[model samples]
Target: MLYLTINETNALLRTAHTDAFHLEVSDDHSAVADETEPMRRVLAGLPPFEPDAYPDSWREWDELVGEVTAHGVTMRRVRVVSEPLTDYVRFLQGLTDRNVRLGEDIRWLPRHLVDQADYTTDEWWLIDNARVAFTIFGTDGDFVGAALTEDPAIVDRCTGIRDALWRKATPHADYAPGG
Candidate 1:
């Protein structure tokens, strides 16, 4: 595992091929998530999700997914969890065409883990397993701060959290907040 400050993480995300994104939103009003949209697009290499429709930017995201798949990368797994359903739903519903994702392959973990996350402020930890990229964000609406690293410990912990989430999450579609 490598240790990268926020800036380094952003850089890696730019070139990361296959990633396992573990995005956590501690705040009900997620400002950090908004700021990282560009990073998301770069890592995903897809257009934004269009809110007007269900699979608004399905093909574009699919193209990106296809690219990863071609690299023998399975679906780029993003384990995002926010506060109350109202908050989480608002966050999910606000996604654009490229960002919008159906529960098809996503896993919804128990919300209790939100309290278990190691952080003092609202943050996001995006782990690119293939590239071994780990990125973190600390922010309030317009003011955002971040850290990025490649430490094996960071990688392992992120992987561990993902594993826990996978084991705890209900199948994506059936996910109901607070359960």
Candidate 2:
């Protein structure tokens, strides 16, 4: 039940020292949006829903992912979103190509369809199937902190959900935001 600042959470995740990193995101938009300057500029420059307008400035992120993958660290992310996606979700979908290129296995699951699956209501990361981190936010939807735990029961539950959602989710390349 340790409440951690966003920076602290990031540091913990970055230092995971694991062979696999898995993440489940339930938010329409993350509070700490991608801060890389090139990504920032491209997102700012695009029109509302430009499908083919991927900016070519994600080198930093891509390279970091390349290094991680090269070291045999498998990374995956699954997002649960509602129909009629929010602008932020749409924006995130637009960025999936970059994610895919960076060696992340990404998936999207429509929210209404998760009726009977093991689920987590909050956003979390299940690292190496051993640790679970729930990211917490403030009232105004600003980035606040995260709670990290190594309880086996908790980890097992989250891992179950991750596996179930992964089975149900749409691959990034085939998923459409409003479909």
Best by lDDT: 2
Worst 10 residues of 2 by lDDT: 30-39
Candidate 2: what lDDT? 0.70
For each of the candidates, the C-alpha root-mean-square deviation to the true structure, in angstroms, is: 7.9, 4.9
lDDT of 1 by residue, 74-95 (tens): 3434344554555434445334
Which predicted model would earn the best TM-score? 2
lDDT of 2 by residue, 1-179 (tens): 77778667655656555534455454444444333333344457654334564343344456666776766777788888877876566667777786888788888988888855567777887777888878787776655778989899998888888888888889998986665
Model 1 per-residue lDDT at 13? 42
Q: For candidate 1, report its TM-score.
A: 0.51
> Candidate 1 — worst ten consecutive residues by lDDT sum?
95-104
